[model samples]
Target: MPQAKDHVYLDHNAGAPLRPGARERMVEVLSDVGNASSVHADGRRARARIEAAREQVAGLCKARTRAVTFVSGGTEANMTALTPNWQDQGAPYYLDRLLRGATEHPSVAAGGRFPASMQEVIPVDANGLIRLDILKDMLAGGGPALVSVMAANNETGVISPLAEIGAMVAEAGGFFHVDAVQAAGRMEIDMDAWQADAISLSAHKFGGPQGAGSLVVRSTARVPAPLMLGGGQENWRRAGTENVAAISGIGVAAEAAEKEAQDWARLAALRDRLEAGVREICPAVTIFGEEAPRLANTSCFAAPGISAETALIAFDLERLSLSSGSACSSGKVSVSHVLTAMGAEEATARCALRVSLGWNSTDADIDRFLEVWPQVVDRLNPEARNRAA
Candidate 1:
């Protein structure tokens, strides 16, 4: 096992290491003295910086500059997008309904629960892709509704067919919202091509600062009632003072990510190498979403009879950090919702580990993980290893 000083991060899906330029941008913003909303000269300079950042973020998603509304994080973006928009105040039925994929992140799940009676779950296939047939059926039977589907899953990295889903939602006259936090920097997202009404993204997912995110809403899309009410900011869509430093950092990160699309190919190759090595050394290991297209940097797999908790600890000991599931639910040691949605048994679900790469990943990182993984698994589940051997 490598020493602590040599620890390698393989949990980029949780959050990537901050880019070199992102920190510098944040520091520069912090050193400035001005409110983004102020009309004064200094304030105007800050506002210009904020607008520049907004353009960079919007460019990454291929969205209009006006479409991006900065928020605290992915959770806030999702909540803002999912909140019901009551068009007819006089109608007997107060319009409140949320449609979400079963494999969504906890934030989406929690937001779906906000309107308790209105929450509907969309099922997923064995590859963790949402069932289009099920979605179509729901849309067909729906009243006023909002459908929340992720562009790419965090745990398994399965990319959803958003363009088709968006068309279906548009046909049904229901709002379509996409959680594109994981897909923002990793995959190509063209809002116009997808025809999505709204999409959510987080800067930290793309090597930007934490606490900075955005909700991109099409011009024709109906804006939901604000969840928070206070000082007018975010064009009165979101309240409270903006985090200028974080926003600036996010913009820098977005610009860098957009300019570095070729990095995905390298990360994909490294991910494939890691999966191949795991399968070769540990024959019982099963790679999740192998039959489907996935994010270039992610590889989620399972080793039977070895719990994800044990594997995570073993990996940590070897100076290789990965995840059992979403970083938000790390300490819970629960079965993955993505795996369960994929039809994995509870035992199999509990044994899953997600290893994700990023811009900083190298062939040596993959080799280091390959060298340590088998020993870690053996140490964690000796009886199972012996049986397999």
Candidate 2:
């Protein structure tokens, strides 16, 4: 195994390295002791910190400060938002159905509180983009539905047309919930522009602590019912003792991400270079969602006769961190649902690999990956190697 300094991390979609400011803020909060719910001075101080963080996190999505609710992570935020029952300004706003994108994260795919019978799947085209015409038809038939689609797919990095989808939902008198965990720091988030009812974000996806995330809504008047019930924390939406350190870390990360968002365009050049190098090595390599808009830092591709499990292990031994797809599956190398939804054959989906870069990624890192690619290809594909000879 290579030394830590030599290792190249290309899995930012899994979780970015914690930013220095986020780490510092976490340490600062951990050094103190205070309960945000307590009435004492210490408690008040803690409360102030949490509130400040709330504002910072909200700013990341261009949302109202009061509309933010701190949740455990992305999964919790999705579960909370995908509910059939919601309130519109203190009145019951019931959703008769849950219509979600076929390529949504597993959290949203599970349909949350909406029973299987009440849920429907919206299809995607071969480009991994939602079939909006089908979505229009689905909306026409359903009673005020809750439309759930991710802002950016984790596996393929494909970005959805959020503004268009949100407009359709609004016109149909439905609620639009965007799982924006992957899009948070990579794209501009304007709730007003998208007319999104709410969007979920995970701090870890953008360089904060893993446990902290937020569900930012366009309006507190329209919000999901509490998934966690007990105390009155989070304005009765989510009830638990505040994780001050993690939340503080999230604030620092959110602020940094918003300011640094413009710099991400540089990663697209790096990603293009990486993909071009792969294609040069294996002329027939498949790049998923290549025709669609994708996250600047991500590239998902597959080479013939190369299995993800083998490549991942080989890459790890070479001190190159890569992934087959989403890291949520406990490291299993399985066919990507995102690819499958886009009509990829099982063999191609099984061989898929994802390389994502972030703030610290450098040209040297991409160079290293290209240098290692040919060896992996030669070892895995004897036919290609013989042809090369």
Candidate 3:
């Protein structure tokens, strides 16, 4: 599908534009023939492609090559990490409790394969920052727990204090898992530095194809049990034939994202400028997680009296692509769970919008938004428009 010349895409958080290298790599793999599980040369080649992708993904997190297990996407990676069936001396070991931050992506927030009765949700501060004190208290009362926290939030771009969380979990003798899907390509991740027992990643979040991701455990010797039982795929950690084409794209994309992180400062300036422009136009516009650490390319903000659904429709009509603060469900912009957890008023939460920039983003995209947004606010809040005028 050809894109309209005037159209602009700013919702990189939802899914980034596919990288050229990744696209080419995926197409190349699509032309190849063989199942990775077969013993023939064709199969051996396919297996090689899969292994290379695993190493590429592991390199992104500075994880051991043996620790990476390919999965379908972030959801599966998270599910595999959350399952309480890690092998300990050939016996099944289960986490006595499961805890997750309130602002985590739905995959982690849903408790993955863990039972709902065994799970507890941790609260976050009004700024959408995790409440460390609360987390510590929650851990104190629990047995060996599996604490899952996303390295960065998808909606607000708020970064968690991973090193601190990891330390606390380690001291409590619990395993710490990081859903680094949003953080993977945007920043450097060291499993040991964050003390993460396992980290989940998705290719589509970082300019790769969707449908391929990985769960990088800290050690191969103590990996989680497979969620599905069948073939010896993914070292018996996951059952299913590998999505070879998508995996190849993921490998190429990860390599590119790692290199692109070096030039993230360029996007930082663009993002800052975008946020500044919006605030200047509407003084009441409040940028979420502004006081907390955030991704360089992400800006989530809202103005009073202007719901995101209204603005999203206007922007879409204007050929400007942006996302609501929360996930868009069934073509509708629902109130942001992230904002609600931050103690934002219901109306304000409904008004929030997220604009995430990336490698393909340009000043023109921001310019278009700045131009169209005022018209939206004017229509939604005529009283505020009068005050601004």
Across residues 38-67, which tens digit of lDDT does each residue of candidate 2 receive?
A: 999999989999999999998888889999
Task: Please rank every candidate by TM-score, starting with the best.
Answer: 2, 3, 1
TM per candidate comes to 0.93, 0.97, 0.97
Off by over 4 Å in 2: 1-3, 326-328, 385-389
Instruction: Please state the error at residue 58 of candidate 3 in Å.
Output: 1.1
- Model 1 agreement with the true structure over 140-168: per-residue lDDT tens digits: 88686688899998998899998899898
Please say which candidate is ahead in TM-score: 1 or 2: 2
Candidate 3 wrong stretches, greater than 4 Å: 89-91, 386-389
Model 1: residues >4 Å from true position, as ranges? 1-5, 86-96, 112-114, 326-330, 382-389
Weakest lDDT window of 10 consecutive positions for candidate 1: 86-95
Q: How many angstroms is residue 307 displaced in model 2 relative to the true structure, after the best TM-score fit?
A: 0.7
TM-score, candidate 3, is: 0.97
lDDT (0 to 1) per candidate: 0.82, 0.90, 0.87
Q: How many residue pairs clash in each candidate?
A: 0, 0, 0
Better of 1 and 3 by lDDT: 3
Cα RMSD for candidates in order: 3.0, 1.9, 1.6
